[model samples]
Target: MAKLIRSIVVSAPSGTGKSTICRRLLAACPDIKFSVSLTSRTPRPNEINGKDYHFISHEDFQRRIDEGEFVEWVENYGQFYGTSVKVINDALNHGKDLLLDIEPRGAKAIKKQFPDAVFVFVLPPSPDELLKRLKKRGHESEEAIKIRFSQSNSELKEVLWYDYTIFNEDLETAVFQMISIYHAEKCKTNRLCGKIDRVFKI
Candidate 1:
C-alpha cells in the first residue's frame, strides 16, 4: 500500500504508558519517523541526547525561544520542552509519516497547524492507578509527583477533544491498539484518496 504522509500526536500525563506505547508502535511500523523534542532539562541516565531529546543549555533554549524556532514550548518542573518548526515542516514536505510524543500543550499547538493530524490521548486504568505508577517510577521527588498528579487532571481534560483515547491497562493490548490506530489512520479515505487514485482510480 502507498503510505500517505500523516502526523500522529500522542499525549499523556507523566508516568502513563505513552512512551512505551509509542516505542512499540515505532518498532512495529519502522517506516514511520519519530519527531524528537527539544528539552532544556538534563538527560536521564539512559537517554541519548539526539535520540530521546535534543538536550541543550538553558541559555541556548531561551535564545531559540526568542528566535521563534519552536512550533510550541511549555515549561514544566523548572525545565522547558519544545517541538521544532523546521523538523515537522520538513517531514510533511517530504511525505514522511511522523509521530510526535509531547505533552498536551505542544500537541494542541501542532493541532492548530495540522488539523488533519490524529491526536490520541493515552490513559492509565484510572487516576488513582496513575498516581501509583508515578510514585513507582522513582524519577521525580515526592513533591514533584504530587504536583504532576495534580496537573494530570488538567491534562486528562484534553482528552475531551482528542480523536482517540487508549486505556493502557495492559501493555501488549495497548501496543496493539496503538498500532491498529496508525494503520487505521493510514487507510482513512481522506488520507488515502491520492494514493488510491494512483492505484485504482486510473
Candidate 2:
C-alpha cells in the first residue's frame, strides 16, 4: 500500500504573519506543497496571479461551483474563494503533503470532506499587536483597518474548533511550531499503519 499523504489547513486573521510562517515551513520541508487558492477578487499590489492566487472572474468561479470542481468554497466580502479538488488530490496521490492557507468558513467546509486533515489556527499575541501590525502595513485606510480589526474577533472565535493554535509573536518560533506539527502528524498511528504492518509481517 502507498503511504498516506496528510494535509495541513491553516487559518488566521489578516496581519498575523501566517503567510510568512507558511513560506518558511515550505522552505524547511521540501516534500510539502502549498495549495494555491482561486479567488474572484483582484490581485493586491504585490500579489502575483498564479503564485499568490489563481485570479478568476466571478462568472468563472460560479461556473466552477456548479461543476463541483472545488473541494471547499466561500463568498467573503462579496468575493468568491475556493480550493481546487484536482490540485489537492494530485498532490496527495503523489505522496506529498499539502499546506492550505484558508479562512475559517472554508476550512470547515474542507473538514467535512477531509476529516483527517490537520487544522491549525494562527493568532497574534494580542488584539493590540494585531492592530499595530495592520497599521504598520499602511496598505489600507483607517476605516479599512477598523473593519479588519472588528472581523478578527469573529475569526479568533473559530480557533476553538481547530486542532492546534499557534501564536505568531515570533516568526521563527511560529514556523518551527508548524513544522513540528507537520512531523508529528506524519507519525500518527493511523498514518504509519501501513509501514507498521509491513514491519511486523501482519
Candidate 3:
C-alpha cells in the first residue's frame, strides 16, 4: 500500500492534558508533524514566533483571511487564529501525518473543509479532576478557573460529534490509546493500499 498521509485534529478542554499527550505522541512518532497555528494574540514570554504561533498582527491576519489563504480560522478568547491551506496540502501530498491541537470551533470548520481529517476528543475523568488539573496550572486566577469550569459542560456536549473520545484519566494509558488509534487508521483500505496489497499477493 502506498503511504497515505493522515491529519488528526485534537479537541479538548484547556486543562485536559491533551497538549502533553500530543508532545509525547510526536516524540513517539517522528514522521508526524504538529501544525503551528497562526494567531493575532501576543506571544508569551517563552513563545517563539513561527514555532509556537505565527504571531501576526491583526491587520495581517485579516488580510490573509480576505486573500482566502487559511484552511480553517476561528476567533477565541478575543483573538483570531488560523491554519494555512497551503501548508496542510503540502504535508498531505508528501505522505507526512499532521496533527493539530485545535479548539472545537476550529475543529468543526476543519472537518467541513477536509472531511478526511480525523477528530479526537479528549476528556477528563471527572469534573473534580478537571478542576484539580486547572488549579494545578497555577496560572489562571480564581475567576478564570470558574469560567473554565462553567464552559466544561458545553464543551463535553460536543464530544458526541467526534470520531473518537479518549478519557485522559491516566496519561500513559491515554497516550498509548491515541497511538493505537492512529496505527489502526493506517490499516484501513481507504486510507492505505500497501497494507491490503501485502496481505494478498496474487
Candidate 4:
C-alpha cells in the first residue's frame, strides 16, 4: 500500500508573517504541496490565477457551494473563499502532503471534515509587535490597520483549538519550527501504521 498523506492546516491573523513562514516551509519540503484556494474576490496586482488563488465570480462560488464542491468555505470582507474537496483528496491520494493557509473560521470548518489534519496557529511575538508589523506593511489605511489589529485579538482566541502554535517572531526560527513539526508528524505511530503492518508481516 502507498503511504498515507497528511494535511497541514495553518491559520494566523493578518500581518502575523504566516505567509512568509509557509513559503519557506514549502521551499524546504519538496513532498508538500500548497493548496490554492478559490475566491470570489478579484486578483491583486501581483496575484496570479490558479497560483495565489482561483478567482471566480460570486455566482460561480455560490453554485459550487450548492453542488457541495467545497470542503470548507467562509465569507470575509464581503468576498467568498473556499477549498475544494477534490483538490485536497487528489493530492493526498497521490501521496503528497497538503499545506493549507486559511483563516480561523475556515480552519474550524476544515477540522470538522478532516479531524486528522494537523492544525497549526501562527502568532506574533506580542500584541505590540503585531501592531508594528501591520503598520509596517503600509498597504492598509490607518482605520483599516486599527480594524485588523482588533480582529487579531479574537483570532488569537482560536489558537486554543489548534494542535500546535508557533510564534513568528524570527522568520528562520519559525520556519525551522514548522519543519520540525512536519517531520515529527510524519513519524507518528498513527501516520506510520502502514509501514508498521508491513514490518510485522515481514
- For 10-108, candidate 1 gives per-residue lDDT tens digits of 999988889999989888897688999999999887999889899999999999999999988999878999999988888778778899998998888
- Model 4 compared with the native: what TM-score? 0.93
Q: Indicate the TM-score of model 1.
A: 0.94
Per-residue lDDT for 172 in model 3?
96
What is the clash tally of candidate 2?
A: 0
Over 29-66, each residue of candidate 2 has an lDDT whose tens digit, in order, gives 98889899999998888999888899999999999999
Q: Whole-model lDDT, candidate 2? A: 0.91
Q: Which stretches of candidate 3 lie over 4 Å from their true place?
A: 1-5, 194-202
Name the lDDT value of residue 85 in candidate 3.
Answer: 88
lDDT of 1: 0.89
CA RMSD per model (angstroms): 1.5, 1.5, 2.1, 1.7
Question: On a 0 to 100 scale, what is the lDDT of residue 21 in model 1?
Answer: 92
After superposition, the stretches of candidate 1 with alpha carbons farther than 4 Å from their true spots are: 1-5
Candidate 2 minimal-lDDT segment of 10 residues: 1-10
Q: lDDT of all the models against the reference?
A: 0.89, 0.91, 0.86, 0.90
Which candidate has the highest lDDT of all?
2
Residue range 23-90, candidate 4, lDDT tens digits: 89999998999999999999867789998899999999999999999999998768899999988988
lDDT of 4 at 42: 90
Q: How many backbone clashes does candidate 4 have?
A: 0
